[model samples]
Target: MACSLCIGTVLPILRRMRRLAVLLLLVLPHGASRGLEREAFEVYHQRRRAVSEAHPDGLILLLGYERQEAQAVRSPFRQENNFYYLTGWNEPGAALLLIPAQGDGSVYQELLFLPPDDPSHEKWHGPRAAPDDADIRSQTGFESVLPISKLATRLSRAAKKRSHVYTLFPHRAGEGKQPEPDRREKLQTHAGELPIADIRAQLEAMRAVKSEGEIRLIRKAVDASIAAHIEAWQEIEAGLYEYQILGPMLAAMINGGCLRPAYAPIIGSGPNSTALHYTAGRRRLEPGEVVVMDVGGEYAHYAADLTRTVPVDGVFTERQREIYDLVLYVQRKVIAAVKPGETLRGLTHKAKRYFDEAGRDAAGEAMGASFLHGVGHSVGLGVHDPIDFSQPLKAGMVITIEPGLYLPEEDLGVRIEDMVLVTENGAQLLSKGLPKEADEIEKLMRGR
Candidate 1:
């Protein structure tokens, strides 16, 4: 009788232990919740470490915006670049708070504030992660996750001792809007005499240089862009409308996993070619005219920019070849001078000098007059990513080298652009596979 009683109790205990083990296995920590890999979250950790090191006594606050689904049609939500840089969290209306260590036996603290999931609303939309989710902390690598409603009260209590708080105030054009007004007021109300400092400068400086992972994402964007340009070369004909060619090219980019265009694809034929930034690709191509196609693709939030000009009928006329070759020559020279220790202004000066000495119009006006814009700009999360143009080029910096000449009188324009990566020794042409030479473009167009 004693043996049978002991067996019954032992069996129940063993079953409960098995259930607990399975539960623990189901909740193993994930690197990120979305499609992001572990490396991305590691990048976030590195950024947080850097911020904490710089501001040992302060707290960093960054607010994320919820998608305005009510105001517009539903679409995929994109997190602000700066916020995404620090945390791989992709949801909307979230807030992040970080407290740095002062080495007084204090520990660094990172917290994420999240909105609750409403089942009634989720029936119309979809369910979202809540503060109590174990993945919320695991995926974001945040120390703790709490309700967003607790932000003001919690921050106010922490800052009551006159602690410094750093945030991204004084928004720039491309930067997202500031934190919610009520929350901003509440933080200030509790801050008393403590002043809020802007951290934009520090963040921009950190983003200017490409890390290994960032370079990989950028290369994916550039490769997709190159494929799109090649498709455009194959499809351009003397009788097709500009949009007709653009349609297939864009399809190719999207099919290749680039869901967004870096910017509007600029397909300008004939007179439209003379108008920079002409995006209305409604013109029909005619034989003996040049078409300038400037388009790129964005992959994983990184961008690629490229421009190529070609003859509409697969052949360049004598005058067309003259202008094309001249522009190509100067473009190559500028690209060759893209090593470190060079500033954008210095490169622009060199381009101007080269154009002045090499070519002239009928009345002897300098070809440099037709050069309308700066030599190039940095490319990254934004097509025209923010940068200090006066700062010397650094290794891992990616930029575009484009030189052009537009002659409205003759109804002619020629531009050649390529993406380049500044390396330790010099530069590497990321878009080298695309044909830019007049002969090569013509040969490719002829299906040779």
Candidate 2:
């Protein structure tokens, strides 16, 4: 009788426990529970290995962005570019540690530190992956995963043996509030004497050259941006407000599977075109004026940048065609010169020379004077991916060739931009799908 009563009581308790477990699983963030989207595991693994090999004498530490309370209502969260480049982890409050092989024959080590899941916060913001998750290591492609709370302990322990710690140091003036600074503070607190070296330069060099996988993602971004431009051509008309054109382009990008634009879509019409970074889309496009639509899309963290200048009406005026042709000529000339061993600064100088020799604008000033900004910039995770301007171009480097002449006096601005992939022999036009020729753009706008 006593054994039967004990069994009956334990049965109800076990059932209640099972019910609670099921409820907890259901409330866990979907992305955390099932693993968020990421590239192939090997891709990140190789990247981490490269960084480790670069700094074998020190410990490499990288911290991701912290969770923002306002982001829930204000904007979506984006992982830090460098951290994302190495680990491909999109979650906030994550850090990566890589230990190089010691001369004593100790093997290299890699660890991913993740924040513990907050069930209460998850109720409001959705499920988040915790370090304790059964599949956390597999999900993150890390051999070892630990709670973020243990980061200080690990750093302290590693610092005892290492002479230096390699991490991103803030070089920009206004970057004090970023993750790098926070990580630096932690290092100071935990490992007082260990020197902290900047790992940004190495990362920048690595990022300047596009890997095959990165190129593929960039191609996707370019294709989506091209499609967006095509949608704009179909929808744009003289009577429409500038903002109206932005909607269709953005819609097309989203439809093409892009998360967002690489940058703010610059929908500059008429005089607004003279402003290089103009984004005000409130103006009504006029029949005789030209509009410069500088837009691109971001896909899977990669970015594409493209610019097209077209007449608000179906055809460009005589003056418009003259300036447009000149810009196109310069852009093509620069792009043709894109090959290994050619430097970006050298290319810009070449483009400027073309603009100067092309002719004078309506104001009698040299056309080159109106060509503001560099001919192009590297494009990758960031639209203007960081690179040394003087560094020689290499195969697999993706850059933009944008040549423009903005004349505020004539309310005329022409910028012809295209994404180019540096090839083993020459250059490949990634934005070839989008028509940039004045005649071709006119035909598309005319619904031909």
Candidate 3:
């Protein structure tokens, strides 16, 4: 009886411990005590360490997008990629400053500067965190948070210390706009003695590898996108405008938790499909034409890219199947060859060989020539996330393998795309449950 009593007491304690562990995972972000979806503190810290290693004793400054003036249309805000990478602060008009450790590697500091909260403005735009908000430290895990006005004074002090400022200062419009009387002007003139480097290349190389948390978010995006594609495949019919099909596509993804489409949804039908990046989703479908739906969505700021060519009707024509099968054959070969240490160039070359050897028409015109554009690109925070395409594939990288054959003469285009994650041994298809084979697609459409 005493042993039974002890067992009962131990079980409840163990259950309570498990519950606490799950709670910690849910609230892992240091300043996320209020239940916001903040990126785990480790992600930003790891990236900061990477930058520090690249430029020890240097100051890294990253600017964020400015809040747009109130106008007729107010779009949701998007965070800057580089700034988000370092701090994961979702608010607009914020900036990040990172100071690498001292010569003894003992003084690493990361500060997030923010716009002070104004109750009057908050009445219009909703409540926002101030520099002194307790949540700022918990949500961002930054060593310090300060008001935006302090930025000028801080930069002046750093300038006097002769610190090299590494930043993407000459940013193009719409990439990420800076505040008025741009801080960049100060960096150039006040810190004229210090040399500034772009540091974008270093960040790109680091972002190429995905962490476990990042992969989970990416997987969520791919799953939502697959659902959107399936909805399009089932609802498409002759005489329906491309936008009509896009309606269900958007609904499905949004309902599945995607914030928005990763890129402009490409719904190209018939001759329109011949254009690589067609965005006009207004074309009405015809009985015999094929449609290409290149669509994906973002989940937690991560992006997914997927493309599938489907017939307007339930089944493919004899000629359409031939081209589709050829692209599929090349895609399968390329996917099977993906593994750590493999180069994208080598895989593209292999695809070219297959297309040449088996895809030539009777006229001796190599059909492979129609295969324009690279086979794939990395996908992450940005749809076409910056990556070294020629570098060897490494584990933890998520990329898309899209191979297409556009035959303008025949008014036919076929492209198949799938997001893949590099693994220790080979590659894992993040979009595995999605049907890509012609037979499977036909079956799904017929069932609808």
Candidate 4:
């Protein structure tokens, strides 16, 4: 009678627990239930192998951002770019160590160090993967997963055997407050005499060339950004605040599944448009004024950069059309020149020459003088993704062709920007879906 009573009571409780588990699984995000949303394990695995091959005798160490405590006001956490590039692990307070193959027949090894699970922390922040979790290896693509407490010991051991420690060093002086400075200081104590090689250049080169998966993500970002721009065009008109136009664009980006803007969106109207990097969207647009809308969306950490200057009244005035046409002409000329073996500096020079020869500003000066910024920049993980400006363009590389003429005297600024992919033979415009022609833009705004 006692056994029967115990079994009867426990069966109902077990069924209840099972039902709760099922309900939670249905409610949680796919990435949360598994791990952070990321590419396949092999993509990261291949990248690690390539890095190991590059530095066969040295140890590569990458430190991720430390986890921040929950606060009333705190920015969302983003993983360190280089670390995320190598390992797809997005969780904070993780570290990656790559041990090169040894001559003594030891194989190349990669290890991921994760913070120990704190039940108290999880109570507030939700559950995080512990090193001992069953699926940690498959999730992180690192066969050897260990507690972060083991990081120093592992690095010390590896440093003693390795000839050099390869990691990102500060690129310049007075950058003491940057993320790299603190991480490098800590690495020095652990690395001791092992000469530290600045691996930043190599990583930048690797990141310049997008993998197939990265391009897909970038295309998604571009698509979302284009949709957002269209929304803005439909809603823009005279007497509306600059931010009022920005509202619809942001909504479109979010609805299209973008995580955030590539950078702060810039919506400058009238005189404000003449200021480069203008983000303040407070001005009330007036008739016959041009508003420069420089915006893009970031999807899955990849970024898209685009800019369009349109008339507030849905029609460009005579002077606006003239400057706009010159800017568009120069942009097309520069983009047409994009191909293998062409340097960004070269393309920039070409753009300036085109601007100078094509037209003059209201002040009778060369129009190129009005072009304040570089013609283009590498775009990927960063809106202005880092690359050696002198390096020649290669296939699979994505860059922007943006040419703008800012004439503060005329209170006019016109910029045409698009993302381009360097192809085997020529260039392919990734953001071609967005219309740049004045007629097309007017039609779009007029809903004709």
Model 1 agreement with the true structure over 358-400: per-residue lDDT tens digits: 9688768998999887788888766787687798999999988
Q: Candidates' TM-scores?
A: 0.84, 0.88, 0.86, 0.88
Say which prediction, candidate 1 or candidate 2, comes out ahead on TM-score.
2
Residue 228 error for model 1, in Å? 0.7
Query: Ten-residue segment with the worst summed lDDT in candidate 2?
Result: 27-36
Write down the lDDT of every candidate, Cα atoms only. 0.77, 0.82, 0.79, 0.83
lDDT of 4 at 372: 80
TM-score of 3: 0.86
lDDT of model 3 at position 67: 67
Residue 21, candidate 3: C-alpha displacement in angstroms: 38
List model 4 lDDT by residue over 220-245, tens digit each: 88998998898788777776789877
The residue-level lDDT of candidate 4 at 34 comes to: 24
Candidate 3, clashing residue pairs?
30-138, 31-138, 31-139
Q: Cα lDDT for residue 410, model 2?
A: 88
Whole-model lDDT, model 4: 0.83
lDDT of 2: 0.82
lDDT head-to-head 1 vs 3, winner = 3
Of 1 and 3, the candidate ahead on TM-score is 3
